[model samples]
Target chain A: MIEVSEAGLLRRRSVVPALLAERGDMLVVAGLGAPAWDVTAAGDHDLTFPLWGAMGGAAVIGLGMAIARPDRRVLVLTGDGEMLMGVGSLATIAVQAPPNLSIVVLDNERYGETGGQRTHTGMGVDLVGMAIAAGIPQTMRINLPGEVEALRQAIHTSTGPLFAVVKIDPESLPLALPPRDGAVLSARFRGALLGPAAHLE
Target chain B: MAGKDWPAALFALLQAHRVRQVAVVPDAGHAALIRLVEASNEMRLVPLTTEEEGIALLGGAWLGGQRGVLLMQSSGVGNCINMLSLAASCRIPLPMLITMRGEFGEFNPWQVPMGQATPTVLEAMGCAVRRADAPEDVAPVADAMLGLAYNTFRATACLIGQRVLGAKTFGIAPQ
Candidate 1:
């Protein structure tokens, strides 16, 4: 029941690091705009996708990975604004009930990547409540830096489908990350997934 | 890919087309396919909270260099009215493979209003619509719709008709 509106940008920036430090290579992060920055900062290492512009695509990709490699963990990094754009997938995922899926929504209450043009998530649309309504097995709502470790623990020992709403500031961007497009990173991810050592890679 | 197996047909069709990522909102008609895709390592199934979220996911999936599809019930189509506007405005090529809910032989009252409005909404949003009246027809119809959506940069629909014979969910919990 944590409303994201309660937090500032810098305070929320810690979610990315918290996830990566906790999950390591066990997760795949995807989405648009600032959340990508979150993904890169968390990886400290780097990430790639073959994308640009398509907003809410990460959750599905994460869902796919969750189902394909049930042994491995998958996390979708998303924006409240981007997610509001692609809501139907929720109902679909709920019914499919993939146990490995964890949809982590970085609710900043605005399309920080889209010049702050307002979003439905900002106007009292409870995203955590919505995920629960959509049938996510577990839902976590937190808007403070202090809650990151607990979230990390939940993700590590998680028996999902878990929906986490980490209230972050819309302006948080990772430092020292280079720019990469969906195509460049996606090629690498594809190589990573399809390569000979896919199990070991 | 049998007559009573729309889900099989969907799986084979998507597999053949090399569709790497697929998205959907849960619906009785689409549940089986979602489960099958969820099991496939080669394909990515994204279960979304809304039809528009699937659209957005497809946009990002495509941006991430992956081919994508979206599935939803006819009633959910009504919820996507504004999102269709977002797709059109963003010029994102999102082709949706949706199940029809309120047409002939329909039973769900919840589907009637939006089911009736499904094609109209797509048309109004400048997306092209196609319907499938038989289970066997879904394969090629879906292929053509995806092709049209990708190549032409226009959203295409493969609407599932009630007459298309298949395993009906009837709101039953999947076994």
Candidate 2:
């Protein structure tokens, strides 16, 4: 729940690349549903995986990977509407206390899934407020580029499950993904995390 | 075969580890345990939209390296169809504490379908269903089921019938 103008969200879109660059062995879950927060650059780097029909369940899936591969970092790239759909996930995540999980929400304040229905998230719901109440150790909300200095500092330096929200614009930049199906992406994603032996096991 | 005290004992054993998160999809049969879960602040309650989500979450929490339990009535097994695929493919061991629904002599017409499907559904997915029929068996069975679910990384089961979790519902509370 960082309150920023729609344009502010657009300017900070590049931060996605920076976030991705800093973390090693972390999986970023994404789909057409997520706002265009430099997903173009991310896809350019071949770094996103789309899951099944569940729109807001990325963090839940990411949690699975974190538990399976305790050695690596697991990050979930999600939206506000999806987060709200599985709101109970927050309480569950806090209880698990996995320091390897870092959830980056590109909150544009609408259900971008169905082509933008207005949502309570954009209506001043204060998601950070929800995280705090749910018992996350740290909730970082950033509206400006410089605020992300702290966000970067927090992610690279921190350990354990952390909640950080970055406000983005509803209107996004041009981005396109491969014509590849969900299966290919899932297989590749799972293979990357759990090698071929994982399949046999 | 069992009595109300059985569910209480199972809850107390699960309650032993500071069981902080419980995910429940509502069912009248499970209402008592749900109420017990909510009554304890140490155990935060996550009431999901469907039992499938509850299944997904229990696995998710375990992966996040945390302990999570799924609470649901037997009928929810039908709702868990596709999700079982995700769990199997991921090889996540989920230990679900189910309040069995629609079994022999179940007066509610709705419980019959999924109640009948319960055993087959769990078996088909390779989930081991352990029934706790009386008060005495509740704790040991629950502790064993919890361990198998977490340690085995496959879905472990506690299929609690009417007598164990509580007596059969007469459609109203007994005063």
Candidate 3:
């Protein structure tokens, strides 16, 4: 396993909050493990559906949301390991080509949740290249803090099945869990989106 | 009812139940249904590379306040076992239309294990399995499964028998 140094990598705690700051009613789906905590730390809102499990399901869930609510921007934040597990989903998302959806992979180059073991990304796997190959219209690799604003704009306003791999530090941080109960999270999210009619459905 | 009519009937039943999304992995058994979904402008047809992705896709669609269905072969059931836990545990409604294989004149030996195991596996995963052995039974079984899934948020499976699909010949080209 190739060792990833934490020296110059972006802090997930800092990047997630910044990206989500201008989120105006955008629905968010956070993948399992660190990405879920990252979104919760950013701010736990009813609009954010954070997965307690379902390791590789985040992006496709975002795809479903994007398809259901075309007017609302849907953003998926997931770890590199999780993204790699369901990487084939990018092709499906691209084929459907929902302009409202964007996927951001927090590529820390390791599986941080299961102990900092180096993942395929650390061994030179190219996630952005894979996204491009998968036919996503827009793809990027963000290594600098300054590039995040552009990604934020693209996510909020671009015509895309967009994908980005944001390089982050491998350093462990405090756990910030959202509601663990899947039923509660699902109901709360649906209620927030559909109002009183949520129960009727 | 002819075998060709069952796919359209099933599609109509799904529409009546307000299933706006159809997530599928390509298979000969589900080809007609897939084509029907793809041709429809009213429903979103999501073609998945693997059957497991269909499980997540449908779950996500449900969470987003849309009803969806998964169409796959019996062999694909193995691929969906672990992912089905998400729907089962969360009580997310999953309505699956599975086509049976490896029974009643199946030529492929590899398909037997998973095909024979499909119903038991789905049952273990908390899905109520209903079988349709004849062309006429497809729509009613599908209707009941959809009702069970959408009205009560239960995981349900409608398994179409291989006899309904007709036995696949080893060498002869299909007419």
> Largest DockQ belongs to which candidate?
3
Per-residue lDDT over B18-59 for candidate 2, one digit per residue giving the tens place of the 0 to 100 score: 455687777665676778888886665776666776666555
| lDDT string, candidate 1, B1-175, tens digits | 5566768887887887678877777777787889999899988766566666666556545434456788888777786665565356444467888888777766656667887888998898798999988877777788788778766655789898866734345776535
The residue pairs found clashing in candidate 2 are A67-B63, A98-A161, A99-A160, A99-A161, B93-B153, B93-B154, B102-B111
How close is chain B to the truth by TM-score, in each candidate?
Answer: 0.87, 0.83, 0.94
Model 2 TM-score on chain A: 0.84
- lDDT at position B96, candidate 1: 86
lDDT of each: 0.67, 0.65, 0.88
Writing each residue's lDDT as its tens digit, candidate 3 over B36-131 gives 888888898899988888878887787778989999899999988888877876678899999999886788789899989999999988889999
Sort by TM-score, best first: 3, 2, 1
Top candidate when judged by lDDT against the true structure: 3
TM-score for each prediction? 0.59, 0.64, 0.95
Candidate 3 lDDT, A64-158, residue by residue in tens: 88888998999999999999898899889989999999999999899998889999999999999999998999987888878888888999988
- Runs of candidate 1 exceeding 4 Å displacement: A1-10, A43-51, A117-123, A170-179, A196-201, B1-175
lDDT of 2 by residue, A1-201 (tens): 233454546343566665666556555655235433355455543335544445556666666556545677666767788677666677767776777777777777877657788788878798788888988887888667677667665665577687877777776445554434544554455455556743443
Score candidate 3 by lDDT. Answer: 0.88
